[model samples]
Target: MIAVILMLSRGSHSRSHKLKSRALICSVLLWMSTAVMTRSSSTSDLKSKISGVEELLEEFRKQLQQDESGSREDEEDGDRCISGFKAAEERIIRASASIEQGAAFLSAPQRVFSWRDCAHACCSHPHCTAAIIQEDLKQPDDSLRCYLFNCTYRGRSVCSFSFQPGFSTYSRVNNSSRPHEPGRGSTATDSPSLDEPPRSDAGQDLVVQLPTDWAVLDGRDSTDDHDIIHYEWALVKGDPSVKMKVTHPGLLKLSGLREGIYTFELTVTDTSGQKSSDNVSVSVLAPAPNAEGQKLFVYIFLDYF
Candidate 1:
């Protein structure tokens, strides 16, 4: 009986040990699963934050690129303006040459078309085709043939308004009160705006007022002996006027100039001739055909920011 009882007790002990081992194994697997889930959650959160930062950086970079592009476009506009001036100069030269060619036709008989006299004749009639190359006409009977043109001399004077041709007479054009139009001179249609400083236009820029007519800076303040020029400006771009008088009479004066966008720089000079400068910009409303030719000159009050 004792031997049987001892064997039964040993079997019960073995069953208890097996049950404990199974519980320990289950607990270890559950712990490892919890750790893996937490790690995955943390990694996902980190990735999300990194993506947000990248997106913000991309936005900043795009803004920077846009700014650079705008700068390049402004430079291109300046170049185009200069090119327009050059083209206009060429057209004047051609028109002057055509005048000479027409006058040469007039002097076929006596054949002495001085540029001065011929130019005068060509400009007499509003729609005259040719000029009287020579004025020493024998009579009106030969005057018709005197104005005949046949491109003979194509010299450098063809484009030269400065050419000194013998002697001549200048007459009123088209019976108008205005004097004979002088040969076209170079026209500068540049308008400079002097309102807000250039540093103000960052995101959405506001319109700036320009000068009305011509504004001359006599160096010093109109009243004071102070020579330093400081640009303390405000935006009057929405108004229309040639001259804008501010409450501060001794400050600044705006004038009407050509029409166009103008970048104005205030050149500050001391008695020692030391110089400093501040920059601002304004846009004058003008047509696309003449935008490059438009000039706006604005003045800013100095001594304030």
Candidate 2:
């Protein structure tokens, strides 16, 4: 595939490399235009593109990392803008190289108290753009999950992970696509990774008469995949728990939560070492009025999911 692509590319590496520099300057314009033009890609494809962008950035950092000598700098200085295809090429090269030389596999790190523990690790690691599960050849899905590190141009999967035997059997939890959305990231195509839910605003209403508030306390997903929500929240201005003001997730039976917008969150680190977080806004207010003629009291509540 890459060979075909290379043949189709208009210029030689030298010329292409120079153009790459220009691409960097126009990256913003290109990104916006691309977003408008490529909305047809599936949700998964979009995720892949975003991941690809992050991968390029990470690979770029590693690529630019230098030794004391100036020789390496000169070799890479020619190409600055990261192309999606080039990034893909680098992965192929690294995966291939890993296959030739012995590769060291790493077990997924432990100490994850909850999902958040593992989620943070993946988010922080540059090489670890996506995550996959480590499986026993015989059991596959039944096997334990592990992290999948980003592969390089020279190392193939088998060659790179042969030594450690830990990274050998794994499945990715994040997409490897190009970047589309700057503020959001793909957790995994279908895997139960952490994802911020759409902020719900239905709960806030003037009819609540009495002030109220609401929140997700150790929320669970509908199927435990995208359904559960483990969150930490504070009344940024009022009490750490809740302000006397109205907010979302209004008035819990046990606590004095009230009428206003409220935030909820859940972070998870998968067995594969990939981690993600979900920040959702839930609306809270006095239940809809029994009848229509209620005095509506509008309250401005600040909440972070």
Candidate 3:
């Protein structure tokens, strides 16, 4: 009976050892599964963060492109508006000068910073043909009073100069090929026939690459019924150091041009003493960099990123 009890105790001890081994194996498997699930969750979060960064970069690039496009459009519109009109010579008119009839005032005088600003204001109106800018000593700049005019009455062009002191005028050039109509109530035999003022053609605007220091201006296309006795060329606005010379009749030579916009005026006076003027602009651009230098710059820029 003692031998039988010892065998039973050995069997019970063997069963307890097997149960402990099975429990250890199950605990290892549970730990491995938990580790795999944690690793998978970390990878998913990393991928989600990467995707969000890419989306943000794309949105930033699109916003930059939109801003660049808008800026380009605004620049183009400003250039187009400013280049449409021509400025006349500034002259002082005393009380002896008579004001022309049929001058239609467009609106009340507007305060502006410069004559260019006044011209821009006039360009905003559809029927505005001319602008008069009056200088005011109280203002910081010469552009103080701006007067807009239609310069047309009924179907005829009856606009004439009234030249007031401290005032300058700018008129829109007629780009159409049509001729101007005759003046009001003037008969054929009125001593000096009321002829149309000479048309001054300052030629098309020009753009030149730099290192070029000279340019030619031709006003040979200016037209008048009578002989145009005088042709005058003046630098309206630009670098004041530039030199000008009348190389021939209705032709001018400009030298020492810099990388900036230069405006020139061409005035033609006919035998009847009637004068007309037109403006032309020349834009000088800086030279482009060498191709090798550009490529090197691009490479350096990319490596920095």
Top-TM-score candidate index: 3
Please list the residue runs of candidate 2 whose C-alpha ends up more than 4 Å from where it truly belongs after superposition: 1-239, 243-254, 271-275, 287-305
Measured with C-alpha atoms, the lDDT of residue 295 in candidate 3 is: 95
Q: TM-score for all predictions?
A: 0.24, 0.23, 0.45
Error of 3 at 98 (Å): 9.7
Q: Candidate 2's C-alpha lDDT?
A: 0.37
lDDT of 3: 0.71
Model 2 lDDT per residue over 1-305, tens place: 33433443445357766577447546755776778667756666989999999999998777666442355543333121111111111121234465234222233754433223333444444344333333345553344344434432122223232333333222222323122222233333543433322121222222222344433343232112233232223333223455333232222221455555555433544334344444445445566564434323222222321
Report residue 73 deviation for candidate 2 (angstroms). Answer: 11
Pick the winner on TM-score between candidates 1 and 3.
Answer: 3
Question: Looking at candidate 1, what is the lDDT of residue 192?
Answer: 24
Model 3's TM-score against the true structure: 0.45
Clashing pairs in 3: none
Q: Write the per-residue lDDT of candidate 3 for residues 1-305, one digit (tens) a residue.
A: 34543444455556677576556555766777788899999999999999999999999999999999989876666665566567775742221222234344666455587877887777676456677777788866544888877664333555667545678877766521112222223222343433445667899898878788889999998877567999999888999998899989999988888999999999999898978789999998897778999999999999999
Model 3 spans > 4 angstroms off: 1-22, 91-100, 108-111, 140-143, 154-156, 162-165, 175-305
When 2 and 3 are scored with TM-score, the better candidate is: 3
Please count the clashing residue pairs in each candidate, in the order shown.
21, 68, 0
